[model samples]
Target: MIKPTLDEEKKETKFSKKYWKYDGLHVISFTKAGLREENQDGISIEFELNDKLKESDDRLKGYYLFGVYDGHGEHGDKISDDCVEHLSKYIAKRLYELPIVENEKEIKNAIKKGFDDTENYFKTHDINGIKGNKVRMSGTTALTVMMTPKKNLYIAFVGDSSVFFMSSNKSKKINIEHNCHNQNELLRLRALRQKGFMYSIKARSGRKYLRVKDDLSNEIQYTRSFSDFYIKNFFSGGLIAEPEIIDKVYSAFNLDLLVLASDGITDRSKIFNKHPTEIYLSYLKRYKGDPNRFVKACDEMIKLCDSITEKRICVDDMSIIIIIILNGKSEDEWCHIVTKNAEDPEDWDNTTHEDELSDIDDQDIYNQNSNEVDDFLVSVPLSTIPIEYYDEDSAMNFTISDDDNFD
Candidate 1:
């Protein structure tokens, strides 16, 4: 049995925004604090697999893990930071403990245990001098993906953060957002018999949306998350840490792009009511097979979100991770191949639609003065906040050239 090596782990700390290029993967990530004093978002990108696993299955070679953690509440930053440091380690430990790597179920179980163990750690230990009560009130949403050498992707997530895959000039959402607005989530909450579990709240645009309320009267938009122990204890099965896992297999030529983003980027209010994936795919199409222009496209997208934040349309931290699957080819070669294989723009579904915010009952709580809503919708403009940029090499087998410096 081969033990996991700490020396090979390439995990970055919270808010380390940079670009990384590996053997067959190119990653560009950015995280900015929007209208908030502190950036509560955390990111982790790691590439590590023991030699034994690679020998057991060729598909396991060159496996890499990346995740985005979006935290909420007073101590949100602390909880997200802890997740960045510990969650990947727990997952790796579970994989190492397995004697035989057979099917996707074993791998999915390992990933699930990682989420459970991370939640248990927070439940038992005090974080950054924060007591159990404070820790219980704070939590984060996690979206993680592990990609293997054979183009197999294992995606697991909780809360509203999302993952998308783009190939053959088409886009597909890979994970479901766990929130009250989702019908399946509503059904689960109803089965629990948690009173006042669903309520309506108005956004800055006067658009009302359904949110889940706990026994403590805290309005939560997400139905599942890590931590929030206070709400979990207040109501029966109020919030959970269990993650939904799914696997996708893509051919080398068809795997063009993978995106992992927080709700700030995907939310309808921030992006002109179009699905974020549609907007992202359109941007990639505009670049026209130019690898050098890909980063610029990402910058433009983030700046669009940042501009909205500055106008106080919607104020929430934003983070995005864009991974270009190279399939062992050069960056330029990969871009040209994707462009050649893509379909016409006219055939794409890029229409903008109105949000379904009026589906809830009129008798439900019209929460205009919820404390949680007030705290999240504060008026700290993004213009007043400085953006931090890091240009150092943060990943193994990745190069940083002078021309490739961050703007």
Candidate 2:
């Protein structure tokens, strides 16, 4: 069956972003159930921006927010299987409390804390046979983006999921992959693969303990997934479980739009060998870079996979989130303010805090080039689409249109 990717859903929703010099948004789309039988995936997404800011400060006014909850392979279905429920709701609730710090470190700490809290909650209320088991392997991944006018723009990933920043200057993978089997991940896993045991006390009242196992061959390689019962001990439920994450925040960094998605985009990444970040940039112009169009393209690709595999190999759950950054400020007013400065420059300009953080140059990244991906390949596509999948004209009555030019 033909399934939707994170990008596809974005095509359905559109929000304006002209108010703020900087803006941010949030979205959390969840997974659908019974995919294994129907051979389809389910998803739900929510997008919102800083509505309150419109009164507090003109520059900090209305913006857009969108989130994604994409499940794939077995992961998406498992969420409905009760592997990762309510977690999506919980995250959406938390993001409603925004105007999050304009500072990068503060933003990072906030996200870290949120994730930690989610894990702690999951540990306490373990799912059915899904926690503390010795052989469970169920988990979910998350991709997120935070942007502010002329402030900081940051994107992060903790699994195979990804978020892309598409703009004129550059299009790149701001989010890092944290899959356990990634080369770097494998090396670290090997180190943690086997070991002995130890214990240490922080002080008179604090204590800690450690236990190490042997290498993969000698030890049990449950990396694929821990038992359903012990899932708690292995992966923190509600976590985007992968490897060490890659994060960045820029002072002058800004974007017209943010694309957050799961591994389904990675499929596109594979075809282009283009990093998820670059996919938007490369195709933005070609696809009018509209979120819906981008996703429709991805959905079409999913169908392509189905055609190739004849519905057998890699049928996966897909999801995406598209955030159009809008300052929700008066266009005429901002023009006056910016133009006022243009006519007469001043060191005391209060427009923004540019260069408030380290300026890191875009690197000659060590990424798997899309062109080079063809050299190492095997193909098995499994995207079967029943006729009924598209029978619905519009799930949300979003005023369909074919006009692609929106920039």
Candidate 3:
């Protein structure tokens, strides 16, 4: 496994000034703490395939993985940090063990097994000497994308973090957000007989948030995640670790760029009037032919999000990874290709300006209420049930069985 160098780690912990190249991709990532004292966000960028896997199959030679984790609750920081360290290794290990790295189905199943192993480990192992059950209250949302040598993309995720795809023709949101407010997610919970799970909690600042209250009455924002074993143990169907997967081929979608980020980047704010995708595309168009200026474009986007938290209420911690797909061309050669096919600047700008912000509502902009309730909630803790409510059972031991259904 290839780990980040000490210098690279320091640069990522702060803000990255330049983009790092990995095979056919140029990547730049940033993560900064918001109003919270601790930053619970984490990112993973793995470029090299395992030596064993490369020797096993030539098709796996250029495999790469990228992910972002957004943690919540008391031990949120540790959960996200561990996820960054463990998830990629688990997935890669599973792939290496496969007899043959054949097709998309084999790769997808490997990713799912990796998630299951990671979840089971957290459910049973002690983190920082904290017992597994107590640590179960903390969890994180994960979004991961794997790119094969053939340029096929396999995306899998749980929770609100997202991956946005941008091409010359169109831009699209790739992963589904798993939250209580999501209609389909709500319907799924309702079908499972999880009634009264949805409610709006009013913060001291009077900003109300719609959240999912588990059987134990622990309020949570995400409907699916890793390490939130408290709810998963009680009502496994309610909050799961299973991730939704989607595949994209290079020929099907001529993707030029991919943006993976936490909800902090997509959160509604007074400063950003349009969709985040539109705003990013606009910046890309402004610096079409210049590869160096593209780095500045990403910096400006993060700065804009930072400006929002400073001017208005404290938003969630922001983490973003901007990827430029180089294919087989040099950076300058790819830039020229995009420039030649780029739409007129006026046309792109006018389209974004004319488009109405119909997708998001003003009140429903922010889903996480961490910053608004940090003060009072910290002083007066919510009452809890007896320990018997979290009684240990064989199921809690996390032995994966053939009948184990996380779907």
- Write one digit per residue (lDDT tens) for candidate 2, span 1-407: 11223332221222111111122332223231111342222233322232322233333322222334333323324432232334333333344354533555554554555455544454455555544431133344454454444445545444555666644445555544443224444444444423421111000001111112122221221132211223334433312242232455643234544556555434433433344434332333334434344344334434433332232222344444444333453433322322231222122112321211011010110113222111101111111112232223322211111111111
What clash pairs does model 1 have? none
What are the per-model C-alpha RMSD values against the true structure? 13.3, 18.5, 9.7
Q: Write the per-residue lDDT of candidate 3 for residues 282-325, one digit (tens) a residue.
A: 66666766746666667667767776666433357778877887
Q: What is candidate 2's TM-score against the reference?
A: 0.49
- C-alpha positional error of residue 238 in candidate 2 after TM-score superposition, expressed in Å: 16
Error of model 3, residue 401, in angstroms: 36
- The C-alpha lDDT values of all candidates are 0.63, 0.34, 0.62
lDDT of 3: 0.62
Show where candidate 1 strays beyond 4 Å: 1-15, 49-61, 100-102, 194-216, 247-253, 268-270, 273-278, 284-291, 328-330, 337-407
Indicate the worst ten consecutive residues by lDDT in candidate 1. Answer: 398-407
lDDT of 1 at 120: 92
Across 1-407, the per-residue lDDT of candidate 1 in tens digits comes to 32221112223333445677666666877787776677888787777654423435534345677899999988998899899888888887777776554457787888899899898988898989989688888999899998655556788888888887777656767666776445566567666653544322222223322221222235566778888888787665757888878655444446678888887777532235444545555556668667556666676677677666554444677788888877677766766665554444345433322232222111111234342324432111122222221112221111111210011
Candidate 2 Cα errors over 4 Å, as ranges: 1-35, 38-101, 126-137, 148-151, 180-184, 196-245, 250-253, 275-313, 324-407
